[model samples]
Target: DKMKNKLNKQPYNTVLRREYNNLRNRITTLTRAARDDYYSEEFEINKNKPYKLWKLLNEAACRSNKKQNKEFPIEKWIDEKGKKMCTKDIANKLNNFFVNVGSELANKTQSRNPRAPTTRQRDSMFLCPITEKEVMEICKTLKINTASGIDNISASTIKNN
Candidate 1:
């Protein structure tokens, strides 16, 4: 409205318009410089900051429709036999490799002892009930930035309670 008023002036005050534009341009430049300086100083102070510094920006980028940094898709792979395999062929090769390795491991384990006690059995043998203080101490040590665990309770919530 102020700009329109200035533009629509009957007398066409060129001096007023020129001053207003000059001040506006200066303000823009000053504001831009100030913002840049602030960000630079912040970066310098936190030069060794972890990924958490850019977590929100990364999440926002992911949420946006624009692709930030796209990676080239792998269409084919070269095998030990110098065979260029398609996605399906690569998957089949992986399945065959796993099957062979798994069969060998299964046979070795079966031959060891049919009734060999597993890690779960060994752990359960030494299981002890946790104290309330132990639970709170563990919860307090948890990083607050982390999301809720499988139990759907956040560390902050546990700490507060």
Candidate 2:
């Protein structure tokens, strides 16, 4: 197939990687710029650029991952209640099941081995505050290109900053 051939071809793959990187760089620049100049008309244009680039990147990834076979549909799923569920219902049922199981496991573990009582002697002198150097070291040790945190800051950004 054309897709398979493209993946195999070194020149094509090089070009593809370059384009993907360029898009990512442009998107990141636009995003930071838009945040600073939120009220500007250019912000409107900047906002949409990332989404468009993301869409193309996602499509390319999907295409790269695809095989010759067509995607198959899930017929149905049976929940713990022995009731047949559709595709939409399956996710919620599985989530609830896993959550309940996790709680049960936690309770069982806690009952089996309880925590020891804390000693009266405190060692506050031994516990020193973390330094800026240590903080930077910790950030540098983190694996890059991972998903952003709840604050929407990436590990690379934190490490670099």
lDDT of each: 0.72, 0.70
* Per-residue alpha-carbon lDDT of candidate 2 for residues 1-161, written as tens digits (9 for 90 to 100): 44335556755577776766677688889987875564354445656788655555555455453456564434546667887778778677678889899788877775557779877757555667999999888988988879998999898888888
Clashing pairs in 1: none
The candidate that wins on lDDT is 1
| Tens-digit lDDT track of model 1 for 30-105 | 9989977866676666667866346434543555546676753445478678877788877797889897997788
Weakest 10 consecutive residues, lDDT, candidate 2? 57-66
**Off by more than 4 A, model 1:** 1-11, 52-161
| Model 2: how far residue 53 lies from native, Å | 34
Query: Local error of candidate 2 at 85, Å?
Result: 2.4
Predicted structure 2, TM vs. truth? 0.24
Question: TM-score of each candidate?
Answer: 0.30, 0.24
**lDDT minimum window of 10 residues, candidate 1:** 52-61
